[model samples]
Target: MMRNFHRWVGLVLSLVLFVAALSGTALSVVNVLEAGRAIRPASTQTVADLAARVQVAHPGLEQIRRAPSGQVSAWWFDGGQPGSAVVDPATGRDFSSADPDPVRRWFTEVHRSFFLGDSGRIVAASGAFAMLLLAVSGTILAVRRLGGWKRWIARLRGPLAGRLHTEIARVAVVGLVLSAVTALWMSAETFEILSIDEASIGAAPSPSGRTGFPLREMEALRALPASSLRELSFPAADDPQDVYVLKTDRGVGYVDQGSGKLLGWQGLGFWQRVSETVYMLHTAQGAPVLGIFLGAMALGAAVLSATGVLVWLAGWRNRPRIPANAPAARADTVVMVGSENGSTWGFAATLASALRSAGHRVHVAPMSAFHPSRYPHAQRYLILAATYGDGDAPSSAKGFLGRLGELRVPPSAPVAVLGFGDRGFPSFCGYAHDVDAQIRAIGWR
Candidate 1:
């Protein structure tokens, strides 16, 4: 029963999942293209070098925004950066890519939040929930077929997509779940659900008796690399009170607006900094090294979804009818069947054909299709049921017990239950026993 439910639920979400994966993989390669666009060959200058350059150009300014790539910008305003520059990759010379460019901001917003704000948050949360269901549902079905966790990932006999589905699912389950949960957490955080203390958000600068320093150090700045800098937020104003904000993946720091002296600093919490790290890894953001591998797996996923749907639809469309090809009361054979994937139906039909020449009434029907009226002339009855996960009945047999209660069968008729299954499954022959008990309960004992 659970197996069929999982499969059907997955069918509904598979299309959405395929689309999301494709778009996400595309967005990951943005960095390579952006670097190509810069035309300067993507150079990285140091903090010391940028500080020296900015100090010389904006002597009156209290703060300078130094890019990891050696591009410099000055900030002394409440709303935004005062000015900016970029380094030419070809010449190792300074140029300008100016801050607050609408293009960059627009792309960033779209990629991060899809520009939908609250609506986007809800949609993302829904996606995460859907993904969680996908992982769990896949896991439940896989484990049932393979029997136990010991051999869950072992080789199984099935079509190409079915085989790949199990194997890829084994390897991808962890990453998939992590991505989903992280997405959920991010959605919650986006709406300010996390408790935030105003003190930690921002604080006023401490009193510094020494307002300015004459000489600034360049060694540290010169050694900095563009790859290390995540973002650089400029100072608020020209007032000596303002400080330059230097943000790295590890922490944040303030430097003297005038002298470039390092000042206050705060280390971001471990998990807080980890947000970007996992997001990049999960989405493949700006990382092309894994491009081929991710692309291949994504294609495999698409194939898996498409084939799964086809297999399911074909089964549903060609399901076995209630009555088998047999005349009334004359034949001495009967076949009772239970199946989730309908693989058992083929076996039942084949069995009926072999017994035809022997002059037996071979009845083939789902467990739910069982009724006293169908076996009017049966001398012997055989129950063929396939056990589902953890010794559970197949979907076709879930209600068979209740139906047996509603209808009483003739007494003392010879009856036998035969369960078909692969030994690899732990629940081998399990549910067929339950069906036998149901039959015995109705005076077949």
Candidate 2:
């Protein structure tokens, strides 16, 4: 059931999830490159010093914003035209254009909402949720396939697609889960479903009618280091009531343009901090190493999704169609098959045909549907079971062990076990051995 659930969900959400993962990977790469090129300000620099220098360099400076990569940017109005530039915080010297990279912006839009606005956001959120589910379910299934958590990294023997799928999943599922969880949180915050209190400094005090107080003299601004500065908006030109608006990692505050006194302050709420942290984690804005790691995982997700679809299709194609099978109640012999890729079903079909040729009624069914009590006329039971990864029970036999344990009384009919697996694996035919032991424990002949 878990395997089927994982398969069908992957098939349905593969396209959207793939697109999200691919775009996220691209964005993370861009973030890492941008971080590499970003300018790092001196630890001793204060926001007051940086703001004062920027104001002196460009008298029309309107705002100073500090990026997560520690890059400082300035926006100004020169001769009635708006302009922006990356600036050296120590000297307030222009170094680069502030315009965003076009490719990075495009990737950002696609990653966030697929450029579909609100509707796209919903789709993107759904994709994130699907990825979370896939990761969790895939983890459980992998654990089961490996026999137990202890053998999670044991040698795997299977077709290339299945091996690749499991190998990549085992390595990347943690990162994928982190990315998906953070994405979902950010999406909720974006849509205002998480209820983060908007940072506000309340109503600015009517600026003292006085003017000409240097920003460097502002006590509140001077107390903050450049590292904590998020953004600072200068008081409006020629407006006595305008106040310097300061936003920092800790909170938002308004400074009187003339007196340089803090007018009002609002600290970041718990949920607001959580939202910001989630944003940083999801975007990898401040951490290049994490960004690269997540990018690799995203790539793995793409490959895993594709391989998963292929494995499912292969299993479907290999499934055997039994013919002229007798009913369980009337059959003299019962053949139960447990298979992951349907190979054991083929063997069961052959065995059933041979039994029929000898004029014995044979009923062929999955081990999952095993109910010896339902087969009253059966004289013997034949178990054809195939082992999965690391000696784990195959998909079709997942429930057989539990059902077998639930049997109040062992069947009177004699039983034989035929195990199937490649010897290349360390735990060859492990599930079959387990079944045989279980049957013996239940006193089956």
Candidate 3:
């Protein structure tokens, strides 16, 4: 049942998941490029030093912001026109113009909201949730196929599509799960369903109506190192009532322009820190190497989705359908099947048809529905079982062993157990072996 659920969900959501993965991969690449081009300042420098240097270079400086990557940017009004640039903290020189990349921005928007704003975000979140489900189900299926968790990395023998899907999923599951879970977390925060403390700087102190003190001498700003600075908005040049607003990794604060005294501060709450960490990990904005690794995983996810669909289509095309199958209670020969992907059912259908052609009453049903007492006139029983992960029962056979144990009366009919599975698996036909053993223990002939 779980195997079928995983397959159908992947089939239905493949396109959306593909688009999301592709866009995410592209965004990660863009982040890497942007990180490479950013101008990083020395760790020992202070926000005060950067501000002082920037003020000298651009007297109209209005704001200085630090990216998660530790890159500084400054915005200012030049000749009554607003401008912004990536800045060098040491010299306060503009290294690059703040021109957004259209392609990256477009992908970002599509990735977050699919260009549909709020509705798109919900869609994106759904995709993420689907991906998470696929990862979990796929892992369970893989473990069953391999015979056990201990042999999870064992070699696999199967059709090309199945093998490829399993291989890629084994390596990429961690990253895919991480991405999906983080995406959901961020989406919850976006919708205001998860309340995270917003950084707050208390009311600004009343300006003294005097020119602000030297940036180098501002005690509050001097205490904040460049490494900790998130953003620093300077007081407006024309407004005496305005005060500098400082945001750092620890919290937010307001600094009096005239006295340079720290007016109000609010430390970041635990949830706020958690949210920021999740954002950084999800976006890989602070770590280029991690970004590249996740991008490769996203690419792997795309491949996994394609291969999974192919495998499902192949299984569906090959599964057999029986016509005019005999009723379970009236048949003399019962063919019970335990199939994960419908393959064992195909074998059962063929066997049942062959038996019926020989003038024997044959019925085919899932192992879970097996009832020896129901086949009162049965002469023989044929069991076709497929082993899933870790020698565990497939969805169709989940409760069969327990049902067999509960039988009040053992049948005297002859029984034959047939196991179907790849030889490369550590516990080949494990469930079939269990079925055969259980039948004997129950006193079946």
- The lDDT of each candidate is 0.59, 0.89, 0.86
Candidate 3 CA-lDDT value: 0.86
- Residue 109 accuracy (lDDT) in model 2: 90
Selected candidate, larger lDDT, 1 vs 3: 3
As a TM-score, model 3 comes out at 0.86
TM-score of 2: 0.86
Compared with the true structure, what per-residue lDDT tens digits does model 3 show for residues 202-234? 576565666568999999988888888888898
* Model 3 segments more than 4 A misplaced: 323-334, 345-379, 396-398, 402-406, 409-413
Cand. 1 TM to true fold = 0.68
Per-prediction TM-score to the true structure, in the order listed: 0.68, 0.86, 0.86
lDDT of 1 by residue, 235-268 (tens): 5343667655667656676656555555666777
Q: Model 3: which residue pairs collide?
A: 143-389, 144-388, 144-389, 144-390, 145-389, 147-390, 148-390
lDDT of 1 at 288: 50
The positional error of residue 444 in candidate 2, measured at the CA in angstroms, is 6.1
